[model samples]
Target chain A: EPEVTQTPSHQVTQMGQEVILRCVPISNHLYFYWYRQILGQKVEFLVSFYNNEISEKSEIFDDQFSVERPDGSNFTLKIRSTKLEDSAMYFCASGGRETQYFGPGTRLLVL
Target chain B: AQTVTQSQPEMSVQEAETVTLSCTYDTSENNYYLFWYKQPPSRQMILVIRQEAYKQQNATENRFSVNFQKAAKSFSLKISDSQLGDTAMYFCAATGANSKLTFGKGITLSVRP
Candidate 1:
């Protein structure tokens, strides 16, 4: 089965530095999404993308966050400035019509 | 708006036994999708099963099955002949027309030998 792939499985960055998490969703899936889980918290939705545009975003997805499908295969999430609270496991998911599949996830630590 | 709730924080079951994890969701949309995702110690999120609101027949994949009650807004996962590999954190999630998933605080399930 084809799975969503993410680069830099683990990353450590200094506070105030910029960080970009990359994901390659399933080739044929139409919808893409970003979600994050702080250590012991429930996974929170960040943003959803479709038709080359952002469909919806959560309040947590503030002005500092941006997502792009820079290429046919790559979906990237850029955080202008990282903070300690931004440390979490970020997951990328893609779906056709019914089910969405998830990537292995990238663990980001802003120290 | 949609909210998924998994009331239990953790559960344990002896290997080969049957275990059920409870999940209830609140959603205003009449059409939606419900899912169960598993994250083992490896920290990889895997889709265990999914249920579509329009389908009255529940979804079953291998050892995993779901009891979906559309009227009550309940979806529960039942694992039969549970094995050690079944030990993981299970998350219940719901998504409406917008396609943004709302996940519940996952429940940790441990399969004892």
Candidate 2:
């Protein structure tokens, strides 16, 4: 089965530095999403992207976060300034319908 | 805002036994989708099964089945003949007309040998 793929399975960055997480969604998927889970917390929605624009975002997705579909296959999430609390497992998902398929996830640790 | 609640934080079952994980949600939308995802120690999210709110028939995938009660706003997962591989953190999630998924805190299931 085709699945969503993400790059840099794990990343460590300085607290004030910028970080970009990349994902390659399934080729035929039209909708993409980003979600994060703190070490011991529930998964939280970050943003949803469709037609090269943001469809919806959560309150947690503030000024520091931005998503881009720079190419037909690549979808990236950029954090302008990482905070210690920004450390978490970030997941990328894509879907043609209601069921979204998820990637393995990228573990981001901002120290 | 929509919310998913998994009342059981942890559960254990003997190998080959049947186990049920409870999940309930509060949603105002009449049409939506419910899902059960499994994350093992590897922390990789895996879609186990899904149920559509409009469908009255419960959704089942092999040994994994769901008891969905639309009126009560309940969707629970039942794992039959549980194996050791079934040990994982299970999350119940719901999505309304919007595509965003609201997930429950999760329930850890340990299938003992």
lDDT by residue for model 1 (A1-111), tens: 899999889999999999999999999999999999999888899999999999999998999999999999999999999999999999999994378899999999999
Clashing pairs in 2: none
The TM-score values for the models, in the order shown, are 0.98, 0.99
**A88 in model 1: Cα distance from truth in Å?**
0.2
Q: Model 1, B66: alpha-carbon shift in Å?
A: 0.8
| Residues B37-73, model 2: lDDT tens digits | 9999888999999999999999999999999998899
Query: In candidate 1, what are the lDDT values of residues B2-98, reduced to their tens digit?
Result: 8999999999999999999999999999889999999998788898999999999999999999999999999999999999999999999998988
Instruction: Assess candidate 2 and give its lDDT.
Output: 0.95
Residues A41-108 of candidate 2 have per-residue lDDT tens digits of 89999999999999999999999999999989999999999999999999999983379899999999
